[model samples]
Target: MKLQLETIIIFVQNINRLKSFYVDLLKLNILEEIPSEWLLLQAGGCNIGLHKMGEHYPNKSEGDFKFDNNTKIVFETDQDIRSIRASLMNEKVPMKEVKTFDNYPYWLCDGEDPEGNVFQIKQRKV
Candidate 1:
């Protein structure tokens, strides 16, 4: 048969920060939010859910902490890559240089959210 993916839940230490990044920054629509507990955002056909990390998850001191995860979230845009990248940079979002391989049809840039979750912004090169 066929399996469908509904939501992707990421355990985070701070829900508001994630909400700010995914909703405020990336412009994803929020489906639900429970303060300091959970946040659900709509990203195209799928939903991204942020669940507050419990006490079992170790947190470093309040300064610099980056979550090391094997997965990366990718966002596709119809807008110009350079323009979008500039906008995010102006908002103080940490982003890498936009690049594309010789034969690649898409231009891509990588960046991290407030809590250090890796994400990519992509657009087709015209």
Candidate 2:
């Protein structure tokens, strides 16, 4: 048996806002969207699905669908890590200082979506 990871459904307060961040700021290709409901975007080999909180749980608006800090979405890029950080900085996107792990030998930086979903821009040392 084999399992393949494909889509990750993240719940957000505002679908449009997250959509714009992923589509406009991050320049991810929009796979599909149903205004105020959900939006799907191309994440290299995978797909990310963003769903509206209110649509899913009409009664839970007390930060129930906020981004989980425990999980970090990491995108491995072929581009230089510094270049990636610079591009994100040019767009005014909040990002932590890029650092390298001495043991693993990879450059990584943490960033967050408008709703605070932690994500990383990383490149393996080559």
Q: Best TM-score goes to which candidate?
A: 1
In model 1, how large is the Cα lDDT of residue 74?
Answer: 65
| Top candidate, metric lDDT | 1
lDDT of 1 by residue, 17-114 (tens): 87889888999998876788878789888778787876645654333434466345667777787888888889998888999876767788877898
lDDT of 1 at 99: 92
TM-score of each: 0.49, 0.46
lDDT of each: 0.74, 0.70
TM-score, prediction 1: 0.49
Q: Per-residue lDDT tens digits of candidate 2, residues 1-126?
A: 122344566767888888879999999998776788868789998788786665334443334233343344657677788887878778877788989845755687776677767677667788
